[model samples]
Target: MHTHTSTVTSDSPLFDADGVLLHRHPDLWFEDGSVVCRAENTLFFVHMSQLARHSVCFRDMFSIGTHSTGTEASIKSESGVDEFPDYPVITLHDSAEDVGNLFTALYDGPNFGNNDPLDFRVVSGVLRLSTKYIIDGLREKAIVHLSQAWPTTLKGWDTREDTARSFEMKTGSSSGHMYPSPIAVINLAREVDAPTLLPSAFYDLCRYTYSQIFEPSEDDPLYVPLTYSNASPAASPGPHSGPMQLSLSDTQRLCLGKESALHAITGLIQSMSHSQSIRNSGVQLQSAFSFSHPLAQNPAHSAIIPHASNHHNPYHIHFSNHRRSSSNLICVSAAACRKDFSELVELATQHYVFDRERGFSDPLYVADELGQLKSAEFSNSDAPECKACARSLELWAARERERIWRMVPVWFRLSMDVGAERTASPPVVDIN
Candidate 1:
């Protein structure tokens, strides 16, 4: 067999050096393979035809000459007597595990089993190498797997959250373990030019406390395993093995996005309990509840305080003066509805909605909690919110959550295209 002989330029001992060893990829090596590809310390004996068929980069390279100018080395045959041809070794500038994963996907197909946390390594490896090699099919598949965690649309986001919540309930651990770390996800998204993944990643990362994001402690809840064990053979040390950090620019964007998310929750609270709305109902609703806290006494806390000294109700005055008919007022029992609204506002404020220390500043979680106020379990009052008032608040909170989802890209300073594609419903992906 004709052989391509060339010198190895790696820092390690020369290929022919005594006692030097190279690991052959367990799955990718084929006896009849026509070419060799080396990534870091591992070598893959794979057929050139399959790679050429799927990757434009490989096709173009093979057309010219496969690794003609790169490192070349010979290996002993099974008998250790005859030597295999010194196949041209295409030195890939990627990690061995990543190359192994890429070849596995190329041969066995990307198995993203149930989009499990461990699947992230495979997905990311395939994504990185596939994009580099211009393997569009693998790249697209990897993205589908990623989308299972970092969804684009609000509905998809909710589904992802529900799955995570369920996982947490089952495992008694932080739901963060259900998916790969968002810091790693963000970095991979940037590396692969997949901006669509950023908003969801950023939003997920926002759930962590500022210290957790910036300086995670050794016993950080984000790293703790519940039921999921990383010791499984399928699990390898990956980006989640340690505190992966965002780039300085990404860090800045994350900070801005986090602050914006906090403000979004505050904005929702303010909108739901605006001063004008409070003043209109305060005098009548004041009979329902009184402020015991000093901060609640200040009118400046209108976002949480519903009591206002203003006696005039513009809608009532408008009706009393015969300027508008009573039918013009949409709320039939303004006092009762307003009373319920104030109690709900107070309930939300008292919760961890604004407490970064408690790591409950996530707008989605806060909004969901608000939505559940219509349910009996989350209601603190003697009576649940009136059907009309509760339903209105629930619907408005749902819409507001969607609006916040849409604004995530804007918050992170991502391009409008990121938000545009994400606004639509997520397309179904078969991950079998």
Candidate 2:
């Protein structure tokens, strides 16, 4: 699903247009290079036989008109692209970076060996170009990694922390730092017939703020850079600045998914809050409020809670002390803890430190929140808290996390788990 931009050369021309029959990128020119792969203004020096061996498309394309007699050769007549008399120039419709990366992956020895580039852009480029150019094996590898990030089973989902995952960024930008663009992931999943990936991808996408969804800042993970293309060096690129644009339906799907996820989480919180054991336990302690905390307990109000996101489309949650609190602090057990449904959700949200713009409806945030119940240090000498209650809450969170994980496909309105997908019945005997 790569959006190709028709390359337009700078009006100044590459060294006097007439003198230059073709422009070769010095960065990619190889001494033994046989073929020239052109995408936008970028050109890559590569071997034809190597490309032909891996991609049936390249094989079939190269196989066409192999013996064109003397001087005649197949060349693209598109503007700004000049066919040269030297090596064969195979013009393509994808971005230069994508084409370059695809060829890099193809030519690179060991097939995903050491020092191989596997960032969001590179993997995405490999996925799209491999599928398009019919490169063997790369597509499946890309799919496997993506599937690992967004598994089809609760087992895979629950054991995500244990898995050799690389979805998060080192800088810690929450929803914005580590993962690929949610919209891009969703679109690519649809394009590749990967329905199993939709649930997690959609859920992750729903966590982005409206601005992050559209115009992600330079600091945000979704922010796309201006790629070097034929459309002048000064021209900006990437999803928001260039050819990649979302359809109306894409917007609706994301909004709907976010809204649904919010409702489900809210319901789960309410249900967890009303447990009979949670209400009756009598424990008193000082408020866990601090200046650094956005929403902390206040003496004026009976309770302290964050403002729930607006209930309209493009909705998001915010932590505002001015908000009328929907949650109250109460001891879950006699462990001297006073935090109710709202408070629990709030604590969990804080643990993950989700994007302020999008709030915390993310499934990942929920898992982290639950994990914190057992691990969070509450027994400070000044604010001495309960470890027993923490352990109990941790167990409950584990159970709830499992339940939520199972219902992911359902929440996205999919029926993948029905029928034979659940089990393999013994083969019926035809002897009767």
Candidate 3:
């Protein structure tokens, strides 16, 4: 606020009228300030040092002796009169509300309100201007807020303790208001090129029907933001209403990502469901007759141990089955073994489709399980009815996990031996 400390003329009312005439916004007014920033024809009185500290863009701009838009851009006039100087105004193209939101986070200390669920407007504004102005501190703060909404890592996703993720309006017609959609967040993420937020945002989007995902107002591309003033709740409220939205190109990319994920995962699951030919892999299942099968009836065959101490012994399995022919290998407790195998499959499937409350559109789960290396989960909990059956089942399960491990990248649809391109369908099952 600037005022004439001295009376310009006697009729000017000496020592009576207010000193300054700059219009001040309710939310943006700072009792003490260095310069005024204008946005959408609205003026925000703020401190120069505070803006400089938080934003390199603002810092660099402030460093210039002149404001680029006005006479401040040039050296003082020959008469030494400033270029319409009313506290060195810097005009910005952003909306007044957005600019005000951004400054509140900055000058008031980023987390001033201490609200659990953030005001969506504040979060979006901070992210937008912070990124635009190269405000690393504020950008990081906004990313922290974003991480709460979309966990960046499996661990973070698993531990929902990160924060109660939600959004609301702080004040205005929308005070205490909840925005029913994440589209706002999603659109803002895209506008800001925020990749970390994409996976969860896209996953959240998948839950909505195509029509529900996009509102009719979205066609305008400009009319969808339920501005804080006179904002109306989206008539059909669900989980994803906000200013952020997916662009057509982004929507197509998401479709591709989903297709690739499902295809690779389905292929991996199919490959894992069937038994592999172990003999071709230099592994064999031996007759354990230890459980009183025909082979165990032959005392001589029962003498061979699991060969645990001798890696020299070729991989083999022993089972008690009625028909012991040259090819068909069977487990004495075939049902139990099958049940155990199913549990592993369930884990693999869960990994592929979803994990840590996060999502997967592909067979990254194969690599994830393989990375864990404990793929074969064996539970001797109640003990199998037959020791020979248990032994054979254990050996078979272990061998299968090892085989799967060796073919992880392949199971994940990688065509190359190490990391070839993944196919949407299962690779040819190697008979060998």
User: TM-scores for all candidates?
Assistant: 0.73, 0.59, 0.50
Tens digit of per-residue lDDT, candidate 3, span 202-254: 54444333444555354332224444331112111223445434566666755
User: What C-alpha lDDT do the candidate models reach, one value each?
Assistant: 0.62, 0.50, 0.46
Maximum-TM-score candidate: 1
Each model's Cα RMSD: 11.2, 14.6, 16.0
lDDT of 1 by residue, 1-432 (tens): 545432332222324223346667777877777777766667777898898889877776777763333213444333332133455556676778788888888888888766665677667878877877788888888898888788887667777877888999999977777887787778778777787888898888887887777666655644533333222122233434445667889889888888888887777666666421423353343211122222223344223211222332111111122112211323435565566667767777766454844654688767767665645532655653445444345444555565677688888888653634311122121110
C-alpha positional error of residue 428 in candidate 3 after TM-score superposition, expressed in Å: 57
How large an RMSD does model 2 have?
14.6
How many clashing pairs in candidate 2? 2
The candidate maximizing lDDT is 1
List candidate 3 stretches off by more than 4 Å. 1-23, 67-86, 112-118, 160-182, 215-245, 264-272, 275-334, 337-432
